[model samples]
Target: MNDLQQQLAAIVGPAHVLTGEAELASYLTDWRGRYRGRALALVKPGSTDEVAAVVRACAAAGVPMVPQGGNTSLCGAATPDQGGRSVLVNLSRLNRIRQIDAANNAITVEAGCLLAQVQEAAAAAGRLFPLALASEGSCQIGGNLSTNAGGVQVLRYGNTRELTLGLEVVLPDGCLWNGLTALRKDNTGYDLKDLFIGAEGTLGIITAAVLKLFPRPRAVVTAWLAVADGAAAIALLGRAQARFDARLTAFELISRQSLDLVLQHIPGSRQPLAAPAPWQVLLELADGGAWADLQADLEDFIGGEMADGRVQDGVLAQNETQARQLWALRENISEAQKIEGLSIKHDISVPVSRIPEFLDLAGTALAAAFPGVRVVAFGHAGDGNLHYNLSKAQRQDNDAFIAATPQANRIVHDLVARLGGSISAEHGIGQLKREELVRYKDPVGLDLMRCIKSSLDPRGLMNPGKIL
Candidate 1:
């Protein structure tokens, strides 16, 4: 081992430092296999002090460092570069739930804690963490915070940024900043925790965090509604929101093509509606009230919508098992799409009112540009975030279609930009969207972000080539 590797081994112990190619292979690539990189060494730090030591060692050697959590990044934020000069500092060993204050509705946890584990912890305390994602089983809280992840629950609880109360980060220079406070009403200056939340590890390494929790819902109602089109879906969403108010926890929109792929690929998956419509909506209402009343209210609302032209057909989940099965259909969209074939994906957002326009304009523009391109649109419609993806029916033609990602992105993202929408809604700009970020980000905002990055990590050794 070289001197630097030896020093890292000394800090975290020899067994925790991995340099073999086979040992480092899994840590090199992203979850979707879109990005693969080489690292000088993979260091597993067990505590904040150990992480600080590892950072110091890398800084002294003038080598870059990639702070990795669960390695489930969609944008390759945690993956190192192809240069093979950087070190991967994995935080899985630091998984720990330090404290949970039921009265304060907060939980303090280390960065390496799996999201599911945190959720279970909150449930054990008779509370809800509110940030729910399909990859919750494997993704870590630090990564969720770093990406400012938004899932189906974002419609009600907000994104990870809003759920975060405080953070503890390791500076690029090896200094640890402990700001893990559970206070909900702190009139502190600048709110330093917000800087590292969505910075995608560019600003610093998030080691631990204090997360906000919510009261556990005593009852939940899940329903699948078939709608005429995006416009009808939005109209129904508005009606549901006005009626249910805060009880509306999730409102996801799924295209017919998206549902078809799920039914074709995902085993045991059945279509909720007897006949498929052009669009489908999965709506959920959670409240502390009685379950029977909640279900009746949802049924009544759906009945009225069906009486109008808003809803074509609808089915309410009768039990928890049925509700989970209904949720499975929505959550399995991405996996089914992957099983079908390769496609270019976009996670963009606009105002809720303009969702119909975005779908229409972007769909028309893409069809004009690439003939026979299947647009798979589905996501949290209540928040106007859509996982808009494109693929050709013929797998043989996908190569050419994939090569035209830039053109497709231009058509879609230009429309999003024109509509005052974000090119990347929940996903962070890692290596995947760096150029697009530069293209769409405002000049003044970009300058300020760069200034903050420079101020925090002047050497640019902390997760280089990410989010900037």
Candidate 2:
């Protein structure tokens, strides 16, 4: 082994340090299969102290360090670069629950714990960890915090940023900062946790975190509704929010084209409604009470809307099994799209009220630009974020369509900007959206971001070639 590899092996046993090409293939590539990189070594540290030692060793060698968890980054944030000079630090071995204060309604966990593991731990204590994602089965807390994940429950519980109470991070210079406080009212100073929460590992590596928890809801209900278009969907969302308030936990929008893909690709997945509509909404409400009472009220609400022509048709799930079936449809859209063929995805957001106009304008422009471009639009409409995707089915034409990502992004993102929205909502600006971030980010804000990055990591050895 070389000098640096020997040092890394010594810090975290040689068995934990992998340098073989076969052992490193999966870690080098991204979940989307869009980015692949090489690393000097992949080390899995078992504790905070070991991680500090590894970071110090890499820092002394003047080599870049990429901190990874779960390797489930959709935007290439977890993958290292092609330079082959950096060490990939995997925190999977640090998985552990440090503490869970039921009275404080908070849980402290090591960064590498799977999101599902944290959720189960919270449930065992009769509480709820409101961040729910499709990849919860495999995604880790560190990666979730790094990307500032916004999932289906974001409308009710907020994103990972709000759910976080404190963080323990290892600075680029090998110093460990312990801000792992579970207090909800610590107004001591600027919340340092916020800086590393959404920074995508650019400033430092997140080692552990204190996450907020809520009382488990005693009653829950789920429903699927068909609407005329985006305008109708937004109108329904406003009325639902006004009526249910905080009890409304989820509101997902799905297009007909998107559903068709799911129905065709996913086996045993029958259509939810009798007749298909242009658009659909998956709504869920959860709180304390008898579920039958909530379900009855929701059925009445949907009945009244359908009677008034606001809702075309609707069905309320009568049982938990049925509710999960309904949720499966909404959560499986991305997987279904991936199974079909090549496509480009845009996770953008605008004012909830402007969703309809943005959709119409962007759809019209893309249709004009590419005649057969299939636009699959769906997302958490309640939060004004949508996963807008474009694709063409013809195998011969898929390559050309994929190559036109820049043009398609221009048409869609320019419209998002014109409507006073963001180009990236929950997904961070990894290599994929690095240029897009620079194009749309404000001059003053961009400069401030650069200043913060320089102040934290002037050497640019922490996850280089990202964001800035």
Candidate 3:
């Protein structure tokens, strides 16, 4: 073994270190197949102490460390660098649910637990861990926290950052900070948990977390509404919010193109409306009460909107199965896009009220610039976040179109900036959008980020070449 490998093996037993190409293949790439990297070795540590030791050894050797969870990063944030000089610290073996405090409505869990596992744990205790993402089956809690993930339920429960109360992190220098308190209100200093929640593993390695829980929604009403355009959808959202209040759990926008792709790719997906409209909404209202009345509320609202000529057509899910089927269409969009081909994707967020204007301007500009290009735009409209993706209609010229990604990004990102939207809504600034972050981030914001990075990681060894 080489000097570095020998040291790494000593830190975490040699049996836990994988160096062969075959064994290291899965750890070196991302889930989306967008990034394929080379790693010197893949190390699996069973405990935070071992992780700290590994980090210290890597730091001493000047070798970069890439912390990986379930390897489900949509923005290539969890993958190692292409330079092949880093070691991947796989956290899957550390999966454990440490404690569950029902009274406090908090769960202490290790970072490697799958999101689904966390949700199930919460459900078993008669509470809800409301960060529900499509990738919950495979994505780890640590990765979700690292990205500060926002999902369908963000309209009601907020993002991963809001769901978390405290964290246990291993600093860049291999010292563990035990901040795993389940306190609901602590005015103690700066909220340290916030720093690591969305740091993308650049600041430190999150070992475990104290996650907040909520009362389970006793009733839910799911509906699919056909709208004229973004403007009408925005208007409908206002009306629904005025009526439903906290029961408004989700309000997602779907385009005709996005629906067509899902129906084409996902099995058993059916058209919810009789005719395809230019815009559609997959909305849900949930509450901790006798929710059978919610269906009536939704029907009455949709009827009034239709009478006012705001809604073209609408369909309410009759049962749980129907509701899930409708949701599958929206959730499988990313998978369908993957199966289809390469596309330029942007997860952007503008103000809730400005969504209509932003869409009109961006869609028109993109259509004018790239004629015949398919723009598959859809997302959590209630959160003013859209997954705006562009692809060539034909496969033969897809590569050529993808090569102009920078030019395309300029069009979308410029508008997002003008409308006060984030270029990366939920996804963090991985290597994929590092330059865009540098270009679009405010000068003061960039300087402040640099100062924080320098203060925490002075040696510049933790997940090098990411976020900055």
lDDT of each: 0.93, 0.93, 0.91
lDDT of 3 at 1: 28
Clashing pairs in 1: none
Error of 2 at 242 (Å): 1.3
lDDT of 3 by residue, 1-468 (tens): 278888878877899899999989887778779889988888888888988998888888888888899998877888887788888988887799999998999999999999999999999999999998999999899999999999998988899998999999999988899999999899979989888999999999999999999988888899999998999899999999999999899999999999999999988888988999999999999987776687888889889989989999989999999999889999999999998999999999999999999888988998898888898989999999999999987998888999999999999999999999899999888888999999999999999999999999998878888899
Q: Tell me model 3's lDDT, rounded to 2 decimals.
A: 0.91
Q: Could you give me the TM-score of model 3 versus the true structure?
A: 0.97
Candidate 1 stretches greater than 4 Å from native = none
TM-score of each: 0.99, 0.99, 0.97
- Give the worst 10-residue stretch by lDDT in candidate 2: 391-400
**Candidate 2 residues 105-194, lDDT tens each?**
999999999999999999999999999999999999999999999999988999999999999999999999999999889998898999
- Candidate 1 per-residue lDDT, tens place, 1-468, comes to 399999998999999999999999999999878999999999999999999999988998899999999999989999999999999999999899999999999999999999999999999999999998988999999999999999999999999999999999999999999999888888968899999999888888899999999999999999999998999999999889899999999999999999999999999999898898899999999999999999999999999888986799999999999999998998899899878888999999999999999999999888888999999999999999999999998988988999999999999999999999998998888899999999999999999999999998899999999988
Full-model lDDT, candidate 1: 0.93
Worst 10 residues of 3 by lDDT: 1-10
Which pairs clash in model 3? none
